[model samples]
Target: MTYCVGLLLETGIVMLSDTRTNAGFDNVACYRKMFVFETTGERVVAILTAGNLSVTQTVIAKLRQAIARDDPEHSIMRAPSMLDVAEIIGRTLNDVHVAVNERMERTKYSASASMLVAGQRLGGQLRLFLVYEEGNFIEATDDTPYLQIGEHKYGKPILDRVVTPETTIEVGRKAVLISMDSTMRSNLSVGMPLDLLTIRRGEYRVSTRERIEAGDPTFSAMSEAWGNALRDGFLSLPG
Candidate 1:
């Protein structure tokens, strides 16, 4: 299991994910669940994934191979629009998922994966989409400006309460870390070495990317500050 969260704010987009995958207690390892594709000034895309590692890796490798082949029909870089890129990834994920599941069927194993794609094309709207294991996807809207995958429940409350289009990039980053801290405290499957990233709108580049490890000073401070704030808020509440 893993955890990945994406925040769509007024200034830009923020995404974070853990690097752990586990088949059992003895089979734990680190694999990046976050993937990025960009052309510096022209376009930038980041994909945060969860579920079956095999499925996600293959799907990404196929996408990269297609791009390398200059196969315009299957290449995300050749996509005419961000929506088209989302569509291509959705189809690839769906196809790869089913194939992997079938291969693992004899062992009674299930392989599945989902990806969150966030990026913008030149002259196109900055958008975010959650593509499911089945190849279908839903876009983030003003009403729901965020999407989460893998162990999402514990961290959703803060996002629901405070995130919005008017949110600043700095605050958005804090919110995601707090959100991840909450999930980490609650679940054993999600661990440290989190990939935290930000893509400022209109820049077509990821302006900030952070690798937060256990006991990182900034993260430690944020976690402590959040705890203090909550305690104070609770104590000051009228009973």
Candidate 2:
């Protein structure tokens, strides 16, 4: 299990994901779940994946292979718009998911996975999409400017109450980190270090990419503050 979230704010986009992969109590490991593709000034696409590690990894690998081979029809960098890039990723994820599930049919394993795709190309609109296991996707709209996958329930309340399309980049980043922190505290399957990325509007490139490890001072302080706030708020309620 894992947790990944993406916010599409007016100033830009913010994405976060945990690195823990828990197959079982005894089979736990860390694997990067955030993948970024960019051509410095031309375009930038970031993918946050959750679900079966095998399925997600293969889908991303295939996407990269297409780019390395310069296969225009399938390469995300060559897509005319961010929408088209989402389509390509959706298609790839769906295909890989089905194939992997079939191969694991005899076992007790599953190959279901989902992804959050966010990016922009030079002269294109910055957009975000939630690609499901079925090769279908939904875009983030003004009404709901965020998308989340994998162990998301534990962290959704903060986003629902605070995030908006008008949120500034810095605020959006803090929101996501708090969101991830909430999930981590409630669910052992999702743990640090975490991958975080941000893209400023119109830049056509990633503005920041960071890894927040367990016990990182900034994150730790924020998490502690949030906990204190929650307890205080609860205590203030009339009984």
Candidate 3:
């Protein structure tokens, strides 16, 4: 399993995903779950994937193939707006899931995948979407300016408490890292290194992209601070 989250804020968008993929206790490997595409000042998009690795990888490969064609109608880079991009991704994911599952049917194995899409076009608003395996998707709204996929329950509480449309990019980044830390502590299937991406509104390009390795000092310090704060908060409550 994996854990991926995207935050839609007034200033921009923030996304994070872990790299761990596990088939069993002894069969663990690292594979990046974040993919980004951009034409630098014109358009930018980021995808965070979760679920069956085969399905997710095929979906990404097909999307890249479409982009390589430069077909305005089919390429996410040429899609009119973020909504169109989401639709394209949803369709691709659904198609890939069906094909992979059919191939696996002979062995009674099944494959499925989901993704979180976030991006902005040259003249469009920043948007975030959660795409399901069935070619359907929902966008993040002002009421709930964040979307998450995989091993999400353990990390959701921090997002619910700290994320909002008004959140600053800095705060949103911290919130997501803390959320990931919480999930990692509670779930063995999710591990590091992590991919973090931030795209500021109107830039139509990634403003920051960082890979948090297992022993990254800054992330380590942040994680420690968060744990300490949580413990202090719990102790402060009246008994």
Candidate 3, superposed: residue stretches over 4 Å from native: none
Clashing pairs in 1: none
For residues 1-239, could you state the per-residue lDDT of candidate 1 as single tens digits? Answer: 89999988777999999998999978999988888999988999899999988899999999999989989899998898999999999999999998988888899789878999999878988999999988889988888999999999999999899898788989888888999999999999999989999999999988899899888998999899999999999999997
- Candidate 2 to native Cα RMSD, angstroms: 0.9
| True-structure lDDT of candidate 2 | 0.94
Clashes of 3: 0
Candidate 2 lands at a TM-score of 0.98
Error of 3 at 149 (Å): 0.5
Tens digits of per-residue lDDT for model 3, 1-239? 89999999999999999999988789999999999999999999999999999899989998999999997777999899889999999989999899888889999778878999999998898999999999999999999999999999999999999898999999999999999999999999999999999999999999999999998999999999998988999999997
Return the lDDT, model 2, position 182. 89
Q: How would you encode candidate 2's per-residue C-alpha lDDT over 1-239 as one tens digit per residue?
A: 89999999999999999999978979999999999999988999999999998889999999999999989999999999999999999999999999998989899878789999999999999999999999999999999999999999989999999999999999999999999988998999999999999999899889999999888999989999999999999999997
Arrange candidates by lDDT, highest first: which order?
3, 2, 1
